[model samples]
Target: MDTPLSGSGNLPPKPGNRPPLSLSGLDFKLLRVFKAVVEAGGFSAAQNELNVGLAAISKQISDLEIRLGMRLCTRGREGFCLTEEGKLVYQASIDLFASVDSFRDRLSSAQNELTGDLNIGVIDNTFQDPNSPLIAALRVLHDEAPKVRLRLHASPLDDIERGIVEGRLIVGVVPVYQRREEFDYFDLYQETSNAYCAMGHPLFDVDEHEIDVDVLRGCEVVNHRYALHGDKANFVTLDGQSATASQVEAVAMLVMTGRFIGFLPEHFAAHLVRDGVLRALRPDLINIRTNLNMILRHNAPRSPLVKAFATALGVDLKAL
Candidate 1:
């Protein structure tokens, strides 16, 4: 081994002999803030999620960067963007949090009663349906496990699927695209939709039978990123500037512009139809029936809260 000494020096410290940095001194709160900011794309954007003021979050992130001795991101007039080091840390943080969640779930399994948060994601505009039964099911779960916290997210199909897979969301109510071996899916119910046009739309004056697929091809319509490719046939997929909306309300608003024709849930469009704001075209031909499915991971041992809510949902749905 080389001597711990250098020329003209009695002794020199070895460069690689220092102790490893211990994470035990790190504040979990600071790390959590860092994670939130990373996921939220910036400190200001994550204020609500962190439930703290902007100054506090900024300080926490600064502390985290100091502790790690690395700059994670840049935020200013140019907007927020993660640095190269931030990307690596973000991925590592995801694994860390997922492991922590698994540990919590294992601890939960030791108890007989259900207690903890149960995240459920559903598509928008379905709550108005009396037959949806989400309200009834939530009521049942609330009574059965009063300690269980029921959280619902009315998000798009992409968020629903990704959230569940990542454990950010525990359950999802959505139209299943393709079956995944990792997930257990239950057929909940179905909703029917039809192509519609605003009163000022060109098709508004066209005869129902005459509004065929060929004519639809020439019309502009509001499209969704998650819209099934097969369902494209139902909407006359047009060529030109693509107008895509993630939220159902945004889609409805786009269709209401009188320039685009798009699909909307029949139940949701009922009021608009009655008000003469929109009219259905070729309902018999452009009809698309979507099957809503309840999705959850199969490999993980589900919390009692999940099971109880699922049971409640089934019971309530059956009553409908």
Candidate 2:
């Protein structure tokens, strides 16, 4: 009897059937090239993006199509377009590459070589306190994971929370006065803010007297615009300014000029008080206690890098 030919007519086949391809059999490099081509809108654009020669890219695409036994792209005068099969393949490629990247990030983090970009949003006032433990933790994290890049964003508490929710920020350090169910919170510390003013301000000398709320009615207050709740009516608003020096040094510089009175964390004003640049307006005034929280998306995938950074900050990720 004559031997049967293989499906591709390359050789005569045995009785057994061909084995199916596994995940490993998928050429990630080729898939990446294909994805770049689709996204770049043409072969030339793909060449520029992939930094590969035009002939090489074309050969790779042709090889990929031959291996799959299907045409993935259609080229015409208008431009390159994806066929139905190409669209499906591109979607799969997106998901596959995203998972692979996550896996690599996790592996790197586990090896304690956690090196990657971390975009962190923070309430500008959190760093105002000179004794803020968060600052110390950041320094330690840098010393340990020097390869990890840190991007600091300063915004209002509401804006910071919004950034975390919309996936712009990987993490946020904010006051948890307005906790929402959609967010996960890690308690960093508790801070107390007291009203303060310039040393020579009239309110600074008020003692043994119940300071009338009217006294502050017309005063120009340099408010830390991020405070969730505070005396709102008495202030000439300088909104969106930070009360924290370490994070918002420019705002602090303005504060140092003694042109405005504002609420400041007690720890932040100690040194400035000693230097007589600022002083408490009324030591007996109402104090506001706020919890400093590390906020992240509730449903966000926990990456090893994020966990490591949280650990360094004394946050129990398990509880979160």
Candidate 3:
């Protein structure tokens, strides 16, 4: 008679007890295929990502299920869905790969010279800051570790922070608006933003003295989503009408429409001001200053690559 099935819907044990599965090169390859399939959602969709035919992908999945003695997922007309066992396996695979990466980092750090990937994330628009030393830091990295691979990603501050926490990025440079316990922030520099108006705006040619809070109360101002104003920086807070933009570029685009006034970093607006495209309302009274920071995951292991990059950026990790 056929043996009974388990609660997991997996077939019964094959006669006597089986030996423990030993991972090999093929197992790793199969796991990678499994991961790609899961991330891509289904076999048909994963074809392009895995660069393999659907039949081969299906066969590999079947092989993985047979090797582990469990049904990892359900596919067919009902669509792709992970079994409870599959969910656990997927999570375990994520941890396993992270460990492997960490081991590689440790091994590279143990060597004499820095040789590994340093993924850096930065908030958008910082390159325009006249005081930014990012290029100088990059030059230091290049000079010190010519063999190291450098990768840069530009994103919003929140996204940059998330990337660091998730191990997708090693370091991030952004303005410190709200502090999180998961990160250690280092002071880098300061950036100041001032209220600005485009050439066609009514306030473009107004005297600096005439554009006060009362006057600004009649016009519409574009709000930057990540902008955090202090007690003294209420230029946009005491507004007449409000609009929102997430990026500085978008803020500049809105200001140029001849309708909305917005705030921008001094360096970012300098060229526009010189070209007669934008004007600062009142740099003395209508400005906000914020500190730019370099952040890293607080408890993450600092490989030599990370140490070298932090040193290049003038952050004393030992001090922290």
Candidate 4:
């Protein structure tokens, strides 16, 4: 059987093209059970969550395999393992359910009610800054839409950008230097970072007055993974020992090793700099000014909740 992972109530005129059975004849509970089994790892492991006996769970899975006319998994004392077909089916099921969820969210939005999941993706370490307005924006959104389920995730700049573009994320908070036409961005705030040298580094003991671009160009410096693209000219670099890190903490750790000098968000590096473990290298010339922006996909639907959240986010910063 070639089951249409998603289905309407009626079957097609050409039976060979799709499953002969219509969706109305199928029980969604069985698909839900199958999902639970996969997520929980096996029938025995999923018993509690599924609220069913082992025999029943096994029978349902067998029925699902028969319905689809394919073997989805293998089970034994060796434990459960999905077949190659099972992996594709699982991913399709996930996308199907996600679409259903989005459909429900759209219905809720149409009704002028704020309900359903709201996904927010942000780059790592924004919470460390005292001036960050994310918390305040969340509070405002929460008050306005008490029923909304907000999911907050911290990811790398690339992952955050992908999330927003894919419609998996409603909004993203990231530092913007390179803008994508697919997204509309609002400048949230300006953050300053500066190059730093660990205690044992040659530049660490160099006097502030003597520190210059030439001095920085003499040592090995770390760069962000995405920094090598556009804005490469803006970054201070040294010869021979360049390294890359995706996150600010990883960059800071690289700098702390005394092997590579790197830039860090001032708020993130403040404690270390204050502890005398590292020195901020020539703040006057090496300060990296970044405009942190809140972004959303240009094509995304502006739901009442999304608009409300954007309004709240922009009130203080005038970012939107």
C-alpha lDDT of all candidate models, in order: 0.75, 0.69, 0.81, 0.76
Instruction: Give the top-scoring candidate (TM-score).
Output: 1
lDDT of 2 by residue, 126-244 (tens): 57665356777778889888987887787777777776765556788887767798799988888777666766566666663646555655455665545655444443354554443
TM-score of each: 0.78, 0.56, 0.76, 0.73
Superposition TM-score, candidate 2 onto the true structure: 0.56
Across residues 1-320, which tens digit of lDDT does each residue of candidate 3 receive?
11111123434345477887798777777787887798678999999978989988887887777667778899999999999988887766756666776677777767767766687999998897878878899999999789888889899877888778766678999998878999998888999988889988999888887889767657788878777665333555444445788898999999999898888999899999999999988788778888998898997777778888888988898877
- lDDT of candidate 3? 0.81
User: Number of clashes in every candidate structure?
Assistant: 0, 1, 0, 0
lDDT (Cα, 0-100) at 45 in candidate 1? 86
Q: C-alpha displacement of 153 in model 3, angstroms? A: 0.9
- Sorted on TM-score, best first, the list reads 1, 3, 4, 2
Candidate 3 to truth, TM: 0.76
Model 1: colliding residue pairs? none
> Which 10 consecutive positions of candidate 2 have the poorest summed lDDT?
1-10
lDDT: which is higher, 1 or 2?
Answer: 1
Query: For model 4, how does the per-residue alpha-carbon lDDT over 184-253 read when each residue is reduced to its tens digit?
Result: 8887888788888898888888778998887777778787775443443455553455687878889888
Using TM-score as the measure, name the better of candidate 1 and candidate 4.
1
